[model samples]
Target: MTNEAFQQLLQGGVVLLDGATGTNLQQAGMPIGVCPEQWILENRDVMIDLQRRFVEAGSQILYAPTFTGNRLKLAEYGLDDQLGAINQGLVAISKEAAQGKALVAGDMTMTGQQLYPMGELTFDGLVDVYREQAQALYDAGVDLFIVETMMSLQETRACVLAIKEVCDLPIMATLTFEKDGRTLYGTPPEAAVVVLQNLGVDAVGLNCSTGPADMVETVRKMYEYATIPLIAKPNAGLPELDGDKTVYKTTPEEFAQDGRLLIEAGAHIVGGCCGTTPDHIRALHEAVCRLTPKAPHASHHRVLASERQVVEIKLDGSFQVIGERINPTGKKKLQAELRAGKLDMVRAMAREQERNGASILDVNMGTNGIDEKEMMLKAIYEVTGVSGLPLSIDTSSPDIMEAALRIYPGRALVNSISCETEKRKKLLPVVKKYGAMFIALPVSDNGIPKTLEEKHAVLDELLADAYDHGFSPEDVVVDALVATVGAAPTSALDCMATFSHCKQDLGLATVCGLSNISFGLPDRIYVNATFLGMAIASGLTMAIANPSQDLLMNTAAAANMLMNKEGSDLAYIHRMQYFDKKEAERKRQEEAELLASHGTAGAVETAGESQDAEQGPVNPVYQAVLEGEKAAVVALAQQELAHCMAG
Candidate 1:
């Protein structure tokens, strides 16, 4: 069986893997001073017997005994002359142990060196060592490459890239980190995950340096940023030598329990590394078999503190909500302010919408006869300073659009462009160059299309043109044009139908100025709210609306809940509790004012009252006596108690 086949076996369920070949070899009569790879070749029977025991112990994936067989390390043993002969012999020994029942992964480990700028190792030289080793393993027909115990991202990335150049086999890489969850060079777990994921490593994880308990936390962090499958191969525990023999203190049961916890944390594949034995892998297999992994839910895109937020534009769906609060659209005050180049107002508006749940903010600088470019620049800078929420730069001027994107951090959604060649040629390049997102309107030089077919035709051309300009299908959002329902009877459905078509055919996301659907209509809020529900069901990713409006904000929250898009309901539930409290308080105040106007003017009283009234007043004759002694106070007390009793 090939190593790839073993990975396939791992995918089907838990697959046992042998561990600690070097340590095992040291214990099995191999001299400690000699290279383990050379010693294993010299005593093939010892290596074969080790693998046989592991296979009998339930290991399905047996790694060849060639941990330091790379040319660079072999030279230290003065055996650089026999690199191929040694590797071939090691593979032969592993294959014989496999007996056609197990898979053999050719082992590669860190060179016990560092790479610059962290250390003296050169990138090219590191790549050369990995490339040389990878070829030797590939030619020997080993199952896969396990580049384990990697400590530096630079070196790891180089080795992985070099291995890919020489072989098409799947690579499983693991980096060793310190107890603080950082590589020796300070690479955080999440950063390492993102870097490795983006590099398209098949399975990435932690190994060698950490034990099972520490590996669980690190694996959780890795799973957060990783899109690919994950692997966790932690050490049994840090070893301490006892009379020339190193010993890992963790029992097989303890290590197995930790392995199961790592699997729960989203490691699809699990095994043991340094100081681990065949018994540990066997127990791990049993542990994994008894456990059920938690399936990860779909993730919402978020802008993290360290990375600028990104808003993906989906233009071809039903209706997109392009948040309008950022633009000086309806407010003459805001328009005048923008024209005057006062950007603090813009920043405040952006922050408000972002806090109120704006997915994408729409920015427009299209004021009467002003330099749109300059206004756009100031607006972009000012808003981005306060809120890193992705923007939809709303402008028709190419120059203004280009300039806004230059300063805006992260990927942004361009307001729009038609299918016209001139607009596409000018705008698409700018989007491509800045890695900006965009929206495409279904209109050509002739203007906005009147029918669904015309709309589809324009959308197709726009998408095709966008792709020609290096835009991926994911980067382009299609706006099917939300025409005013009040203006034309066919407008609303046409927009929705176009949205549906784009989502299904073009596979692009859609956006619309939802308010435009009810423009000039009486009771616009009702129409806007109803239209929004329809649009969301139609696959709209975002919108440009006043999130401050209760209806819009409530609708988005409710929609997220119903659609199961929001991860948790704690925030919404808490907000509802606050609302319930406010409503109760308002009712209480109104009831108090009613009672005070009709009855005696006194402090509000609860249903249970008169507990502190004078005990003597409990007697009717005493009450009558107090009525005359403290007439006003007694009268007020009587009124309150009477009201409470009546109620």
Candidate 2:
């Protein structure tokens, strides 16, 4: 295919590419530490056979034996002077091998050493190498240039820019990262996407460093940052040293399954690298072809943010249960309002929390001196009107609960009904009749269970009542009631145990009033943030906390990615861009203030001094005010206003 045609291919359905070159050549007795490109010319029969196998395996594009044909790499084996001859021979041999079938790409690998800031190799030097290599490969009429196994963004950008400068071929670049999901230089997937996408690569993705499962995650992350097509060329799982030879344990069928996942994760191209065989590629080809192509418009419309999962309008997926920030039980303002029988504090809390990332604001009108039922209704109207993010109505009063549930829009979470006899009989029935999801606290009439087993029993009773109340397992969030850590040092552990039991045993998602765990403690923010992370790690699906606190909000944002809810660094980048704009505005105001105070006087001095002595003494201060320094202008305007008023 021509370079333009290949670009078109990327925009359509899945295109299969060739598998491992080194492994195939090694099995054919190509010598190690020798030039694989040179061996392709010498052992033309094996090279031809390899190309034919890839074609048979359904590779629409086959790479020429040019992985190490660059000047710097080829010079290692004293073949630097043979760049044109070696590349020309690869084209000549691979064309004959293909017998006019598969499209050939000029393959380029890393320089195997170091680059600037870490090594001696300069950006210009690296580009010179790739430029020369690309020029030779393009002149020989290769279909595209594949820059493979790159780890450094700097080096990769240099290579891609250099190649594009010399040749107009389509470029597919892949960076190799360690199993930790980061490059050797610690470049994360999100950073890689921004760097490569901005650098103008035709396609950007991961290859050669990880297995299928891990690669699936990598590809998913790449999709978040990738505007271009993605390529997945994972090894058949990680390779192992079987005696003297490295062996890939995963079978072709198993490998194909991983390839299928990469396809689902939005990979437009699929192939095997290093340890894959034609058998692997053939299975992948069949596996990929059997699957119906995803709709172009459908995939494009799908929204992904930094690892935060959307709480859709459905009752099945995890809902963004915003912890109600409207309770006045802890706050003095709300406490005084509660005594005065006012519910306006609840309204303010709800609006503030919703704006700061609360999808479902938790509303609690349970303070002394208040008619709980009367207060709940007033708060609901005030909150739902300001923000359309759903509400979590919290109260034990059946009358109060019924009133709030009547007005709540979308799917509302009732927080909560305990395992207490009266709660099960009264509140549970209300939740069932209203078609609202309920929070089942692992607490009995005597209060929250102290031990995990007791909490488990409470949850069991709550679940039984919930099902009897006509709620499914998914419709309830078992609030593993976070007890204050300072009240009893073991409260944190007990809370964690409750979370685990609800998730692991009952198979129910859990939520917690995260702030309670850190209450009455120093650095409560730290405790709250730490507990939220640990609670999430223990399988807490939802949380109730102030999302406005950077510590708290950041923990949740981090949890989204860690839990694989949000796609990847895509969300993180978004947060930064938003925060950066905010920061820039603040800086501009500060600069303007500083300039108005000090800078305006300096400008006035320079302007006044420019005039001749023939002119009467000029008022620099008046000139400063006239120059539109708002701070100075305001000072003068205020003085004039005072004189006019005095007169």
Candidate 3:
């Protein structure tokens, strides 16, 4: 009836949840391929009896049989319109069967479609699907919600986001894993822990992939990172084909033996999936009823995450440089291109930033004439499709932030929010709700903090606001309010002090708009590059700077080497050398083609190395990249560009 009630069952020790509703229902004379929800509605006694048996067998939490009632899942049977009635009816039957004895959880499951980038289901579309079911389930008087058998972590994230929009019921979610110990899309156990636990799911773990033996290993691995309670619902071992019927090999006793191991492995709740039965639950309950729950592992949450990777934020670690060159802020050419809806340049910039080792890309499409929200979303669409890199969404508008947040398929970092009460009150909730990281600029009503103490004061307030709104401290990436050196002679010193304060004093991840240090300074790249190294050595973990700046990039490479980033020096060498080799091969081909077309520059190579006595003069651009001579390449590229423009 209450979370307190549900939690009470867990506190007593391992809480036993009911076994497979689909498997039990099929065993009870339902026709193959018939709609389970409709059939259960018509035969309420059969549904009630099945659940009552689970309760009798010692299940403390009963999942209502609404797994396939979501609109998308039901649409396959042409019963999408019946979604509301089906979900409500199933919950009602579940509650009636529980009869105030066991906690009834409103069950949800995966739709057969994939999420965007993986499949066609848009994030908003997924939200709508889960929202409708959540509303109906809440109205039907369920105690909690369980999203089980999920295959994709993105879709599970959308479901949790949607359900949170309509209800605050404790959400216990689980993803089905493959034999390789990751989701088919490569979501590892740690990524799942990072995403779901941060979203505040009451419980999470594996389901439907393997039997007790495999699930125990997954649970043990999950325990290494999760601070929240973990659930385990394994199949009764793998199923096999026997004649025309499928059969699960693990006996009830063997399944129960595995359940005991799952409880010992730190799972708070143990249930069955796929081929489990009431007898299986009974045996599992008997086996684990006496075992005490183990204390959960400590949580580590300072990370910049995408759907596929979680980059930890650590000062001694490799710096996280979010490429800032994608913004159209002062880039007139890029702005003009965006205005014309030509995103070819945007895609090219994304590729370039990634190649330059930018860990995250900062996308800012805000300009005067065009709709910033529309352009921002459009640019995000193009960039995300082509780049695997995570995004740092730069926007000040609440509407745009929420719109982009909904459509963005992975966890993203918001460009900024400050200590201004109105903006904080408006946007922090959105950031919290979507589980996004945002740069908390140290700016109070006094304006951007000019002194280190003033910056600290603002950061303190921002942290309070974020915490009050349910954001973890790790989600607040500190910007430290970097100021231009020319604007204030002491600005560079003040900025470095605050940046250090953020990591050392606040124990938080730090980022900066590093270009600010070079603003109005002569030979800006030199100042920016030097300050970047200083910032990292002083505990700045991330920098928002132009990745295309060769000096800045070369400086970062050396900084990585100094910080002991694994293989950093060797990687830099290979990258430089590979470019040179490719350039040489390209030069050879270009010269051969030119000789065939316009006859050479009338020069011949050394006698032994001369190319077919008829070859044209060598193209130097090929030689530049081939030789890995960066200065030569830049000169050749500029020369080529000047010639093309003039001709």
Candidate 4:
């Protein structure tokens, strides 16, 4: 037990976690659409009184009413700068209320920025925000951190990783899943356990979900593989509208009846989530006391995840693309625009890559005579906030890496680390601290490895360094030293050998700069696509390239289908649909131009046709209303409502 008192309680039987903070606060006159933390600070007595009731009701773990007190969420109230003060204030009040009775946890949650592939938040950014709040809570003194009601597995990962970095407090991570046992974002029970348990959280469970009964199977799934204690804090059987207020459907007795299912399923902690009262907690406390934890089972250990989904990288699984267009590496126009303080192009490129099926976007803002750190952070924010895809934080500077890594909302893939001692000393700790995945470019004091023997030796050194810094092979993606054919004709052949060796022999995932194969060549996209197909055939799991190229994307999609990629054909089909429309539009433009060859008369007629297409048909409802047909309009509106209801 990271917190001694809480651990002792766990040893006896089921440790009791508290009921809903929001619902209880609302019952005490805290309104919706206002910051709960701020309201609690203003009405301290209400919160303290509510907590006292929970303690009396037998809750041993009380989460502080600091759910959305992080800087990003607080920024909505112009309170971002007061994050520390707000968190400190929360811990102080909760501690005072606990008063040597129930232990208080520093409650943290998401920034409402949905993590990448779902919404704009980055892993590093989420980690930074949570660390800021955790530090404050620890400073003001709290027993542990409870990141609850988390809707995304990746955001939950960020929160736990962040807390582990800032404090040694026992961390409990609970996610909000739907009745189907997966989160709304579709992270099933065991997938979440794989990620959370590997991160070494004290307890993993479901909270703020449908009800205790609905969570039993989910708890069972987790129990099957969870070696640590499991938690089950569910809603009081969903909410219903009680006139203007929300009400819990499950009564105290009924809710407690559901707890037996979770307990039977091997839950070590049982409590309530939304709409649960102290009465509910009291019943649960009594019921949970009679249940005992069951033996745990073993499971697959490696998990690399995004905010909304998990990426289970088996020995031979699906290939992934990390789009390279977000970087301003060799593009003069983008470089000029970025230096001029613009991100429109970066956003456009991000969307384009996402459209072309890039699993992640590689972002590099390094340019001469510019604040690389500032630009990288902005680019990360723009790409992530808008495109909402995972990113590779591409930078050589340690400061730039740390800055971008801190604020990125999803788990980021670092572009590199080498055998340079200073680089290792500075970069490896940051990666380990944040728990971000990384790409290993094995450069030793002897320079870039030229042979399999040299590359293997360099890889061995990097692996040793990584382990020394608390990283695992599952956390690494080895960069295929794909050398340019112009520099060395056999470079391409040697690259293939390295990629095959890494994926097949060494059991490591491999990434390559795809366009490097066609450098200094004409029709590069076609060449790159061909090389990409060969690479994919050779077991290259990842590639950093321009996903916007039709040929390259087509080739990649084809390879996935050829390799029997499950469901990848859907993306390929969508691409075909897009290309069909594109071809149609191209033909239309050509036809229109040919028609306009008769000069101004044809062009004018074409313009008129375009205008007619835009106008479409007139609305009968608007016409009737304009003609003073009130009764007809009323009939139309009522009919529309009826149709909508029927539909």
Candidate 5:
């Protein structure tokens, strides 16, 4: 189905989705430990009857019984060789059952293999798997695609990318959150909404982990950030053991009552999950059919997200710092490490900057004697493993940027898209495709604009081009083109004017390389911090800077408080508390190092020992992997294996 058509359907009212596929099929004599898709094809009449009941009972959309039809899952029953036949057969059955009454969505789910750094599956490998299944479903003429019961947000992204690569089918994704309202991988509901919607999912929400009542709060959380439709497909209730069988005790009436609460809590689409039947969907439809669906929250809220956190960028919100320490431009140590294909320094920098309150981490892997794209991907994997902060993919190469965005697994901020011919031609489409927010540098083929008028003109042209590529102002963060004050006396003033114009006149967020204003000057930190305060006053949204500098970070906090930005007072106070705690820890580490420096046998222990002592309890193997200590990992693994074998 076209996205426009699907949206028009939602505009009519609440979109009712069909209830439980696996659970209902099991009740229809589908045996356990057998391939569900294969069984459905063998007993097509039973499957058709069940779905037809849902359609008659008021399900506007029916999920085809292709949930586990992906190649990997079918391989468990040795049906992988017939993957195409199984998926096509299942879609055909659902289409037959629909009989023009409802639309058939090609259902998808997790591959049962975890993504890299957790299990063996690589991101590209998983995408290829979903691509094969999605192609089969598309060939079978499924109207749309729905990826449900996803535990990993990364895996969901793979599925959406796969489907989009195959066709422009309307895709909806839902995660199964734990009772505490986070996925098994620690992604919260709001993060899921922000990340998936930004990745171009037609609808994003929760399904299967809990009953309708317990899902209300998470639905509300997702609603606050959602710019697309929200879906709630909760179970009948918490499953219970009844003798030898699993049962859901909530009656259809109770399920229907909670379904109304879900609609009220901002779910535009409502459905049933485990233990829900046609009767339950009928009750739910009766309960919520008349109520007006809640409209999705309006877009243009500038936000970036990692897998676990969402960072909102506002024109007047707290000043955000995109940590700049991960770049290997002038850092000789980092450059050497990158050349050796080691990401230990990169991982350390990411963790340190996050601890220092960086809102985003800027990752730039450009260096001599190293493959930039290869190192960039490696850096992304390492940083995401250690930090929950969203990353700024800083690269001058469009090819590298596309490679990074394809597998980065979160909503990244493209370090820039300028009006330069090569950049506009190559980068804009990929940025839009990945749903990334980008730093719009107002430099064209003629180079830096000499005047504020010229700069604004460049920005206007770039924005017009972005619009042509289907981007909104919310997706564009204007770079105010920071020129050195040492070169132009009025450079800082011009930049502040650009910031004010972008914020007040154009209604867009702004960012800058914070230290560029003070280049070729003495005590650059003071100049940098002072300029940052002024920029924040003039409506700067975020800046790429070294967040480890207390002066710059404190000035940002103080500026936010002075501007009376919401929650800045508490934020400043909390920052002070964190500083105090950090200072105490630093002093304790110093004393421990001093004591260890003078060993009892006059052989000074290394600083690593002192730090390890202060940190308490170490998993050496895990630490070795985290630090990218390849030799240490090999030695440690061999030692552990030898011990296991000897025992």
Candidate 6:
């Protein structure tokens, strides 16, 4: 069926799907330990009869028993040579069973071969395997595609990408979550929803891990972030070992009762998995047919995700810091390490930044004397392994960006796209295709805009192009174009104005490089910290900055609290507690050193050193802000806002 028709079908009510192909076939005298696809094809009459019973029992969608038809899986049974015939025959059987009364979904799943960094199966190789099976299913004319019982989100992504490359069939994907609400691979249900929905899957959810009652919570977690329909094809219940066979104990009535809970929790589509039969599907249909389907989320959240974590970007939420130390631009140590083809430093930096409270990490590998694309892929693989923070793909090369996004196993944030005709033209489609949020730089082919109006014009042009490529305001974060305050005394003011404009006038999130305004200034940390506070007060959503700087980080936490952003009070208190502990440890080490020296002279010298430290020049305003002296900080914030408005 076409995507339009599929959507219309979902609008009618809960889309009922067929249940338990393999188990039901086993009950029909297809023996265990045999190839399911081969057995189904050999016993075509029985396959048709079972599916016909489902169609009669009110299954709106029937999955063709081609789940194991991929090249790798067929090779397991020495039926590799007959992959096409086996898949086509199964589809034909399912179609016959449907009798044009229900839709037939060409089902696919994992190849039982683990993907790379874990096993020998290359991602491209796996895609090719699925591509081969998808071709035969398309030729045989299945209505839509359903990839179910998946345990790996990346594997699901490979199948969806392969099928889209082959044909534009409506695709639905569901992963099986363990009892702890994560997949076997540690991917949580919400992360699965974010990753799959962004990859253009028409519907996404969990299947087969447990019964409907247990699956309801997972469905609810996904519903908060899902902008597409959710599918809940749960097993009949937890499996039980009965002699030599595994059985589910849930009766059709019990299964139906829990199926209603799935609907109430936001499952737009419902079905059964292992241990379910036509009776379960009929009971589910009877229980939920009249219940109003919960609509998908009204708008897509501005979110970035890794395999296990999601970082949401909200316009009025707590300020976020994108760790910027991963780039090798000015870091001699990092650049040297990258040239030697090592990611030890990259991994270390990822961990350090996460500890320093960075919401996202920016990874840029544009140094010389290395294959940038290769290093980028390696960095992505290494960093994701070490940290759960989502990456911001920062590269000037479109080729490197595409390669990273293709293999990087999460929703990334592109560092930038500009209005420089060729750059936007080449990269916009890649970003959209890979489902990445991007930093939209308001730079045209003419270069940085000289005036706020020119910057606005550049942004307008770029956003128009982005909209043409199907990006919404939530998918973009505008860069406020921070110029050096040393060069232009009003550059900071211009940036603050741009931040306000992006957030208030254009309805987009804004970010800036926090250190740009501090270039050529003495005590750069002071400048950076102060500008950060002003920027936050002016509506900046996030900043790319060095997260290890205590002054900058503490200023951010304090600023967030002063602004009364959501959850900032507890965040500020926790941040301060951590710092306090670190401070106490430092003093303990100092006392130990003093004791080791062991004299009144040593104590006098240490006291003098402390006195000297306290006598150093300080920025009282910035210090008061960091210390949470709310009266002074609030007054300064008000003054800064008044100045910003007056300017």
**lDDT of each candidate versus the true structure:** 0.71, 0.71, 0.81, 0.79, 0.91, 0.90
lDDT-based ranking: 5, 6, 3, 4, 2, 1
Instruction: Estimate, for each residue in 504-595, the C-alpha lDDT of model 2 and write its tens digit.
Output: 77667777777888777788899888887787767676777776676677676676667666443666556557556656656756655676
Error of 5 at 567 (Å): 1.7
Q: In what order do the candidates fall by TM-score, top score first?
A: 5, 6, 3, 4, 1, 2
TM-score: model 1 vs. ground truth: 0.52
- List, residue by residue over 16-71, the lDDT tens digit for candidate 3: 88988877788888888888888899999998998999899999889999988899
Superior candidate under TM-score, 4 versus 6: 6
With a 3 Å backbone cut-off (N, CA, C), the pairs that clash in candidate 3 are 580-625, 580-626, 580-628, 583-626, 584-626, 600-616
Candidate 2 at residue 369, lDDT? 77
Which candidate do you rate higher for lDDT, 4 or 6? 6
Candidate 4 lDDT tens digits, 355-436: 7778888888878867888788777766654555667899999988987776664566889988877888899989775557
For this target, which candidate reaches the highest lDDT against the unseen true structure? 5
lDDT by residue (1-647, candidate 6, tens digit) is 78999999998989999989888887889887889988887789999999999998899999999988998888888999999999999999999999999999999999998888778888888889999999999999999999988998889889998998899989999999997889988898888888888889999988897999999899999999999999999899999999988899999999999999999999999999999999999999999999998999878999999988899999999999999989999889999999999877898799889888999999999988898999998888878877889999999999989989988788999999999999999999999998999999999999999998999999999999999999999999999989889999999999989889889998899999989998998989988999999999999999999888888989999999999999999999999898886677578668757776776677756765665586664555675554434346777777778888999
Q: Give me the overall lDDT of model 4.
A: 0.79
On TM-score, who's better, 1 or 3?
3
Candidate 2 has what TM-score? 0.48
- Pick the TM-score winner: 5
Off by over 4 Å in 4: 1-14, 20-58, 64-102, 108-141, 149-166, 173-206, 213-231, 240-246, 260-268, 285-314, 522-526, 568-575, 586-647
lDDT of 3 at 218: 83
Candidate 5 displacement at residue 9 in angstroms: 1.8
Give me the displacement of residue 273 in model 1, in angstroms. 1.5
